[model samples]
Target chain A: MADNVIIEAPMPGVFYRRPDPEEPVFAEEGDDVDAGDKVALIGVMKSFHDVTVDTDGVVTEFLVDNESEVEAGDALLTVAPS
Target chain B: MFEKVLIANRGEIAIRIIQACRELGVTPVAIYSDTDENAKHVRLADEAYNVGGSVARKSYLDGETIIDTAERADAGAIHPGYGFLAENADFARAVEESECTWVGPPSDIMEQFGEKTQARNLMAETGVPIVPGTTDSIESADAVREFGDEHGFPVAIKAAGGGGGRGMRVVERDDDIDSEFEEARQEAEAYFSNPDVYVERFLDDPKHIEVQVLADEHGNVRHLGERDCSTQRRQQKLIEETPSPALDDEQRAALCETARQGVAEAGYVNAGTVEFLYQDGEYYFIEVNARIQVEHTVSEAVTGIDIVKWQLRIAAGEELDFDQSAVEPRDAAIEFRINAEDPSEGFEPMPGTIESYRPPRGIGIRVDDGVDEGDDIAPFYDSMFGKFVVTGQTREEAIERSKRALDETTIEGVPTTIPFHQQVLGDEQFRRAEHSTTYVEEQLDLE
Candidate 1:
């Protein structure tokens, strides 16, 4: 059984899946990510802050939709340790 | 007239602006965060858009996002009601540079008055009496002590970019000046992003009086009398009333005149407020609030003028229809701020779901609020849920009416400042109008 870890938003802002509109998503479901891998970005006050995953895991699902408003501590995605 | 006007704000003031737009036959557009999805303003507006997250920085303060929303919604104008980006010169300039009209004073005027030292200097140049202090920012604590030595102790070291008593420190003696000055600078930097500070002689037991002024592009400026906001706790106003019982007729006329002249000299347009500290029959200019204030309702009630509607009309290039002589203040009016705080618990914020909410209603009473029963008072924003205003023919009548209205109000699930307001109405000193700015902290013990 895989150990599931929920990734939460570090700050309150609009959660974006990609770095820019023309850029591809940093990670997707079923992709294996290393420790300290960038998973998302939170855009607020005219700036974007990187949201990174700490532990090595496989991205299982995105809990919140792309470009959705999120609060601090709100779950953004779910990851299973590989 | 604008076909659609976007209100870049939330809460009661947003509702107020929406109503004004409706009366003017302009569509109202609302922008909300995640927490304010079900807010009253959102429901009332003709069009609503999601701005950003729950916090102000992500939503209300995001000028680029707000402008983009206005552009997407095809709004012809934007009304920034009071807080958030209302006083931001950059946001004002952005709106100016955009297709949407900015319903506020010119950006240059905002920049001039945004800094306290600059405002003081402008008022001084216009012959408006200012508090004795440095007209420029002090570089070190030694500068503060030197000013104190000349002006006496109990001096106030205030942040140049701060207002509403956020970045102010009062040093009573020589020993505390250095520490207070450093603390004031740090707090100012943290809050206003500006570490520059200026020193002024702190007046003891002074009346907090402010004059409302309206100016148009046609170069006409008029004063809308004054309001006494002396009932304050920790420099936050709890109650405000017009035709202050403390000022005589002669003094009131002079104060209003000075406010008009000072703003006109600065080339200020649209609605603004000039605040003053009055003591011993003398009034000194303090600062200018370049945006519409929360207590503007009090002045509107007494003068029979719709200030919000006028703000829209002024922004649309309308001249002042009425002159200063037409601005007549009739009956006395008082406004009570009903905030989500427990007065008994030292006014700590107690945000929660309002299980039951019933505001007072009847003749000589008006209630302006943003929440309904079963609505959650989010901790992400200001704790003020409503404002109750009462008006009567005389000051005594207004006071009595306020007591009756407060008693009739009901709220559950969260502690309110209603109890504190009740205690104040029943106090003899408050009844006699003997209270000053420090009255709430000194005379009344809520515990």
Candidate 2:
């Protein structure tokens, strides 16, 4: 748990855990994820950008609320080694 | 006509609808997000209600909340302008079931045109030429390849449930089909909540032409001519104009008639736009925008028609009081989208407060904006805050006037698309009408 990494938003916009409103969240807390897996998306200017995980880990916690405005470098989630 | 109408949207379009309602002697009600407490729309509205939080899903996209606001305001009709819930057939259906009338096409027609594949099929059945593509959604890359094999490479995979360039990808070679198709599918799922996609022969270079059609509930359909939206980057239009320089008089008549017939056959009503892609000498029906669009003002300027006013009238069961011949667009017009994006920084969104705002004014310029000086530009919404529509006797005159209008226009504090528009207006190729849909991406430096 000490070796954890926090992912941050690359730009400003609304962040979404689920791909769309009705779809299931890409990953939930305590769920295992691999590198290159998209955990969320940053919605901006009628476009969507995938926020992919950079390392294999278990999602420890989501740091930001879904569909909330997020700025660049804002902490999105915390991940620990699986 | 409605005694009062609720506008279930925000920004310049909301203002546009409010003006229309006022002109028709109807009270205009407005809705706002948490960040839009001081928005221009709220100030201009006879009554304003807060929908929800800053995020669109919590606010403007909340159909039930908007409907509730309409009820609270006692508005007789609801106008969903351009975006958010504008083309949502489910929302329109809900409005139909409610006490308020929906000020657009019927819910069934919206649903019909909302699904891209069904639209293509319907247009084809109605004798309108559709782009060479699948009338059904494709399931895999192999199916797309089959289409590419028959129609050739560089095929466009488009979302079946949405338009306006989202969830669309162009696969240039057979080797890139699998990856591109997957990306398009994922985007389709992300945006439209549906992964269904269809393949089409991607015209390498085509002029984007759309006809403005207004159909009354009584079956009178009139076309307000076509606009050439050729100057675009990444399938997003930057500038649009009517009486396409590329089309001759015969082609223009044929295209307008085609759109009118297509919508008439589909039993469409209210203000809608029929979009097409024109290449060589042929034009193909792409899709229909079942609500008033951003570029509708250009058509309005030339034809001297108040399309939004007509939307209210038609929704109230009034017949179109004019004939197709009487719907003559005398002059050419061009609309420039004033967006809060930096041309220097690759046209990136730079939303902030407008320290000072002054739109151009003169003989042939009309400005539709949602913000004034000192107003904050919300990042959560679309980048476009306003549009500067210019008209003149001919395309050359319109271009000349546009350069002056754009120069006279001034928006302080945030980076804008003005510089990019200014550059395009100066370009010889653009002035002479030689650009296509991919013109901006291939040629201009966005300076």
Best by DockQ: 2
Q: Residue-wise lDDT of candidate 1 within B1-447, one digit each (tens)?
A: 899999999999999999999999999999999889999999999899999988687899999999999999999999999889999999999999998999999999999999886898999999999988786899998888788889777788888887767889888764667788899999999999999999888898899999999999999999999999999887689999999889999999999999999999899999999999998888999899998999999999999889989999999999999989999899999999999888997776655789999899998998899888998777667788899999999999998999999999999988899999999999999999999998898877775
For model 2, residues B1-447, the per-residue Cα lDDT tens digits are: 789999999999999999998899999999999989999999999899999999888899999999988987889999999889998999999999999999999999999999886898999999999878897899899999889889777888999888876878988764677888898989999999999999988898889999999999788999999999998877678899988999999999999999999999999899899999999798999899999999999999989999999999999999999999998888889999999988787778866789988899999999999998999887789999999999999888999999999898878988889999989999988988999987898876665
Candidate 2 chain A, poorest ten consecutive residues by summed lDDT: A41-50
lDDT value, candidate 1, whole model: 0.90
Q: What TM-score should be assigned to candidate 1?
A: 0.78
Clashing pairs in 1: none
Where is model 1 more than 4 Å wrong at Cα? A1-82, B134-199
lDDT of 1 at B347: 79
lDDT of each: 0.90, 0.90
Best by TM-score: 2
TM per candidate comes to 0.78, 0.83
With candidate 2 superimposed using the best TM-score fit, by how many Å does residue B29's alpha carbon deviate from the native? 0.6
